[model samples]
Target: MAGAGPVVFAAAGVATLAAALLPRVLSRAPISMPMVFLAAGALTFTVVEPLPDPNPVTHSSIVLRLTELCVIISLMGAGLALNRPVGWRRWSTTWRLLGITMPLSMLAVALLGWTVLGFGAAGAVLLAAALAPTDPVLATEVQVAEPVEDPEDDSDDEARFALTSEAGLNDGLAFPFTYLAIALATTPGDWLPHWLAVDVVWRLAAGLLVGLGAGWLLRKLFFNAPSKTFRLAHHAEGFVALAATFLAYGVAELAHGYGFVAVFVCACTIRAGERTSGYHRVLHQYVEQVERLLTVLIIFLLGGAVATGLFAGVQWREVVVALLVLLVVRPFAGLIGLARGRTGPRERVVVSFFGVRGVGSVFYVAYALEAGHFLEAGAVWRVVGLAVVGSIVLHGITATPVMRFLDRKREVLTSP
Candidate 1:
């Protein structure tokens, strides 16, 4: 007990180093950095007898905040990584994923949770809402890597952009459904009107307004300020990415809106302006670093949670539910969503298959469990834990190879 603090600090130092180094080494390999740290966390916790249990149910509050932070920061990074300006036709893939794939996935997952997994109505909806978004954190392999400094060089690949933009928007868009679950749980009989008025309409509007407003203001300060001292772009400090992230998130929350949406919209808004500036790259890189560090902690704890029997009381059917979500529901839903879209068949398949789940899943589950009274909280946690860990292992292994194959095939098709 006396020496645990130093051990934690030392372990953190090692994790930080791994965070910095592992991405490059694992980039082309089938393995991912999240996979390595996740397994490491499980192994370390399982072998060591003195470590504190990292159960989500046991420490819901800490898990809630940590996962929340990871999601918001990662949202900023994902948003900043986009190169294309937003337009209906340009972002048709994103709209398809968010408007169609996400809701369809949620509906299917909810049905599975209720019928196959034996969850109640509220529990089923919570499960669906928890898993509504493809996690921006763990799906980095399938996402855009960084902002392009050159304006003319568009790094916009359909599959990658769809996944990244979908993850960015859906994490926030999924909130209203999450609140729907909470409303159903707490105020079942008369919840519809209140849900529509507050959760769906007002909150969504507030987030969009706050995000746009904050993004524009920050853009002015960062790029077009009259005074040199006010221009943050000149400094290139990089930490301002965090400042922008927090500012957008905080303002949106203060407006009683979805902070996740605000953070992402703010990043995209800032990015839309001055597309050629090197500042976007600096901001993206800094956000990526911070996101990676936070991810190490969350995924590590997740692996520890697994080793400590996060699925101890889980049923075989619940495991089946988790598997179905990844293998069947998401893939089919994504395919159906992308039907008639601009993506080629192969790109559609790639986008549909890599709906990776990670920190965002953890955050929603924790948030709902903490806010609403659920009898199946433990069971739900086990199923969600299964889903998230399953995703990390499954997607982590397939991401590099599949993306490389797609890249190779694209080059072949376009060659003269």
Candidate 2:
């Protein structure tokens, strides 16, 4: 334990370098950056006894804030990279997933948690709500890679767009359910009306409205400022993305709104500012770097938590429920939602299956546990951890090869 600080600092430097370069290196590989870092963190934390524990329950505050930051930054990145304009018809896939798949998925998971795992009402609902969002942080492989400036190049294809947009939009949608879980846990009776009014209505509306106003103003300042010097986009200050992200989120939170919704909406509004501007790309790149760094650290700590027996309390029923979540509930729900929709059969399968879960799940659980008393806190953590790990490993191995195959099929179909 003597002088462990220097070694930790050195390891931090190496992790930072890997974070920058891993995406390109692993683009075509079956393994993903998350897999590598996750395994590395587990191995390192297990072997190095001097390092601090990474347990979520022991350090709930750190986990909550860190995961929240990662999710919101990722939302901003996803929104900015999307080339598709906002429209009801254009975003039908996202809407379908949000409207149909998410609720169904939540209902199914909550039922399983209650009946199979004996999680009780509040715990079951909390677990379901926590796992509802397809994590924007761990879904980089299936999301938009960069801002699409050219109309001819539709890098944000149907499958990618569906996943990306759903991931961007659903995190905010999941918050109301999380609040429902909190209300159920804390209140003995008469919470429904207030929950419907405040958590469901006011928070959601405030987030969207705040995001719209902030995005509009920021877009003006960035791209349409009267003076050349006032136009930050002309300078290509990548840090402005962070400024906008934090500003939108903070303002929304201050207004008693959902910050996750505000950040993503703000990003979308900024993207709609000047479709052809190269500044969108600059901002997206910076946001991606920041998101990547935060994701790496959080995933690494998660791996450490795994090594430290986060799953020691996991039972057979919990295992079964977690498996069903990834293999059955999400896929079936997504498929049903995507039925007779925009994508073809193959795209539908990919979109349906890639319900990747990561830090956002952890954030929700931490937030809920902090806000309300859950008797099954340990069980919730165990099951969520199991599901998240399963998602990382399963999706990590398949994302590259499957997406490559999808791309090849699209190429064949489009070839003249």
Question: Highest lDDT: which candidate?
Answer: 2
TM-score of each: 0.98, 0.98
Predicted structure 1: clash tally: 0
State the displacement of the C-alpha of residue 6, model 2, in Å, after optimal TM-score superposition. 1.1
| Candidate 2 backbone collisions, by pair | none
Q: Model 2, 12: alpha-carbon shift in Å?
A: 0.5
Deviation of model 2 at 410, angstroms = 0.4
Q: What is the C-alpha lDDT profile of model 2 across 1-416, one tens digit per residue?
A: 56877898899999999998998899889999999999998999899887788999889999999998899999999999999889999999999999999999999999999999887888988999988999999988987788977755655789999999999989999999999999998994999999999999999999999999999999999988999999999999998999999999999999999999999999999999888899999999999899999989999999999999898867899889889999999999999999999999999999999999888999999999889999999999999999999999999999999999999999999899
Candidate 1, run of 10 with poorest lDDT: 148-157
Clashes (N, CA, C under 3 Å) per candidate: 0, 0
Off by over 4 Å in 2: 151-155
lDDT of 2: 0.93
